[model samples]
Target chain A: MDLRPLKVSEVNNYIKRLLLSDMVLSNISVEGEISNFKHHYSGHMYFNLKDEKGKIKAVMFKGDNEKINFKLDEGMKIVATGYISVYEREGEYQLYVKDIRSSGIGELYRAFEELKNKLEQEGLFSQDKKKQIPFMPRKIGVVTSSTGAAIRDIITIIKRRFPPCNILIYPTLVQGINAPEEICRGLEYLDSRDDIDLIITGRGGGSIEELFAFNDEKLARTISKLKTPIISAVGHETDFTIADFVADLRAPTPSAAAELAVPDVMYLLKELDNKYDELKSIINKKIKAYKLELENLDTKLNLYSPLNQLKDKKIEIDNFLRDLTYVMEKKLNEKKAEILELKGKLELLNPNIAIDKGYGIIIDNRGKLVKSIDSVKLGDEIGIILRDGKVLSRVENIDEGEKIDEFNL
Target chain B: MNLTYEEAILELEKILDELESDDCTLKESIEKFKRGVILYNHCKDLISKAEGEIKILLEDEENTKEETFSMEV
Candidate 1:
């Protein structure tokens, strides 16, 4: 190596060239506590980042400084991203910060919280403002990166759970500076259509910085104002963004959002089957009850049947006939006895009986019987009767009751 | 019966209610059972006949057109 005397400016210029040539040094990120933070009148930010054993001077121009989301102060931990270069005049190496963000919490996170609070105060996330998701959505609109895992997962889930739902996808950029506008456009496109019943806007899991677009104020407000119900499914389950709060519903993942949007066909089919079974059983019960009622009515009607009443009446008539026959027999017997007694009495008085009892009877020729001699005229002839024979003889005189003994022989 | 799924379900529930009532005549109950069976079949068919279809809404310079959507995955 040839040794040559060099000026301080020449060495500084050479160091600057060396630093610029190095790609890693030109683009670097340094995380440390901010010590000397100053906002100059020229609208530039000057700061020094110091860690436990090292420190570096950092500067952000007004243009880049305006991009920072949080106010920079001393003793705040931050990650300054920029190129490392050597200043010729000062002959010192420093970080030329292009952007500064809070180290753990992140400037994007702060902005998200700020917007979330503001919108919350505005009542954009009120429950009454939320539109109920249709139980059976005919059409669903999806806004996400066309090629990301979010769309694939959503489509697969929706296809598996509920088939007939029409899915309309608005392919959009999900990150970077232009993502918010594209997302808004997608929302607006879907909102204008009357056929879409629901909208799902999301992307796969990513770093907080990668998900910054979802925290955009314009996008959040756009989601709040959409006529159609929106479900926000962004990043992982733990990642909460402004869009999540403003949306009508927040799904932990893209797959979850699809589940919430539609119902399972198998479950509905099972419910229908259960309903059918219940109806059949109920109808059977009704039939059984009606059969029982009919049997009871048959028995009741038989009790009052006309044929049964007629049979009862026939039995009563038979009983009355038997009683009448017994009374008639008794009366006939009594009459026979009285007739026998009269015959006995007539035996003392009748001619035949009197004849049998050694008494005689007389009759007139006209065949008329004379008890007191009033019926007979004592005219031509008379007859005398005995027990077994009769004889004819002439009647000489008529006998009254006192002279009846004269006829006796 | 050409009842939709929801209509069929509603009619089926009504039939059940009628069958449970004490005043329903046997003739009327039987008629309701027949109708309920028809509605059940209608609802089941409606659910079973659904085919999974995906559609994409494409916007061009002038208008939006809907087309069948299919992916390799």
Candidate 2:
């Protein structure tokens, strides 16, 4: 046999080959509680497995971790099966975990529930902080796994219901260790944008363990504080998560969330049309009533006009008084003229005027007039009066008639 | 010949409150609606008349050299 010195790298490579080929040691199993676990960027997990007596250093490569059945956590008792391996640089042996399972309910679930309860008691899930979703959102924001089927279902449902509304999707991790932080960041991004009216956060159905990120307390509080209304559509309807309680609204599925965020365009159009018809009828009736009332007021106004009433009464009384005054004046003038005529006639036929004209009068013994000479000659006694004085005389009838004719000539 | 714009607006508010309360009878609603229509028309007419008067006032001001201050100012 030929013995030769080897380089440091060569010896380490040789030991790595030997470890890969050793089936018996690589497949061995150990059961213990986890301590001081760390996952490296090289896709390997490093930790210690401890029993009541002592602890052993362990390593689980990326491939072996894929085969693990349950999540590994500090203080969790797990049964791990893997190969025995040695790090050449450190000159230390470590158990590489190929398989892992929970010995009981495990510490991971307890830790998850503890954090969730703390957040719940803090009122992070209170409905008062939840915003109301717009009746008809003009823009909708979706936060979900970029490659998941949930996004596809939401898009399809929204398109079918309404075509005009804008839909914006923010890619996010829905599972794994970093999912919670990524989801919170995505929400902050959408909330900063003024155009987004509502947000839908969810994923397709999954087991409770797979959906653990949604139950994160930080993520739940971030959702509750979002200014934009958020609709949680996390697993199936049966699967409730902390996000569901904290979001503004909860939907059974991704499709249901889209429906709640927007109104049906056709339905809205029909409503507008109906309102237009109703408004038209109301205005028409108002106009007709207004016109009729105006006409009624016009009639009343004409009825109560002071000028017309005064004119009617004035004309009737004026004519009546005019005719009365004319009749009274005519009667008064006629009476006065008749009195003047009576006075003139009396003046013209006065007996005193005849006496002033020097006419003589003869009287008998009883003051009677005698005109015939025969009456005086018959016996007697006669009296005569002149203009100046009265005389009593007796004469023959023939002589008296001659003297009266001579005076007349 | 009815109420002014301010008076009509106040009445309209009353009627709207009554209608929203759901306590008014159908007959009462109809009567109120009729009165509301009259008031609304009166308000519209008053507004138009005011606009016309404003136009006339503006024309007169333009023809003259007087300056007037606006209430808003």
* Winning model by TM-score: 1
Clashes in model 2: which pairs?
Answer: A26-A83
Cα-based TM-score, every candidate: 0.59, 0.47
**Model 2, span B1-73: residue lDDT tens:** 5664457656755755564454665566567666666655664554333110000011244352213212121
Give the top-scoring candidate (DockQ): 1
On lDDT, the candidate that comes out on top is: 1
For candidate 1, give the lDDT: 0.84
lDDT by residue (A138-201, candidate 2, tens digit) is: 6677888756778878777776666655667777778766778878988997899898888899
Scoring only the second chain, what is candidate 2's TM-score?
A: 0.62
Chain B TM-scores of the candidates: 0.74, 0.62
